[model samples]
Target: MILTLIAYALLAGLALIVYLSWSFSPRLTVGVAGLLSLFLAHGAWKIFRKPTKGRGYRALAAATTAGFTLTAATAVFVLFYGAGCGCM
Candidate 1:
């Protein structure tokens, strides 16, 4: 469980670094973001499944902290930062 969380954190870090090179490497940025999201989802699932309950809660707390940065950084790109970025 802890290993999964650590892997997620590492991917999150890579995504942040990739975000800095956005204009020059948009595809890489997207790739890293996708990886981070995958790991987070996997970790969350593992944490949820464990028999020990608080471990999941604690992991969720940590994930939320890590996820805040991801959302803040990528919201502009993925969440329709503008009013009409083709969304309905």
Candidate 2:
């Protein structure tokens, strides 16, 4: 329960930081998001590999998976459009 809440809070904090950085430097934001996507991909892989224990674990896994997907999408988008944005 508490652990899940903490995980969610940390995830939200990371996303919020990345989002807020966009206005300052889109390239920097994309770089950070790319790094975070890698980290979260590893986390999601580890979580999915483990056996299910409880609802909290499953919920955390789902949240991590979603975060990973979003960050990855953001990183990929930057790769396609970053050169034209003047931030690259």
Clashing pairs in 1: none
Candidate 2 on 11-62: residue-level lDDT in tens? Answer: 5676787678987899987888788777698666955686666545456567
Q: How accurate is candidate 1 locally (lDDT)?
A: 0.59
Local error of candidate 1 at residue 31 (angstroms): 0.4
Q: Could you tell me the C-alpha RMSD of candidate 1 in Å?
A: 12.4
Q: Would you list the C-alpha lDDT of every candidate in the order shown?
A: 0.59, 0.66
Task: Give the runs in model 1 whose Cα sits over 4 Å from its true position.
Answer: 1-19, 50-88
Clash statistics: count for each candidate: 0, 0
Candidate 1 lDDT trough over 10 residues, lowest sum:
79-88
Error of 1 at 30 (Å): 0.3
Error of 1 at 23 (Å): 2.0
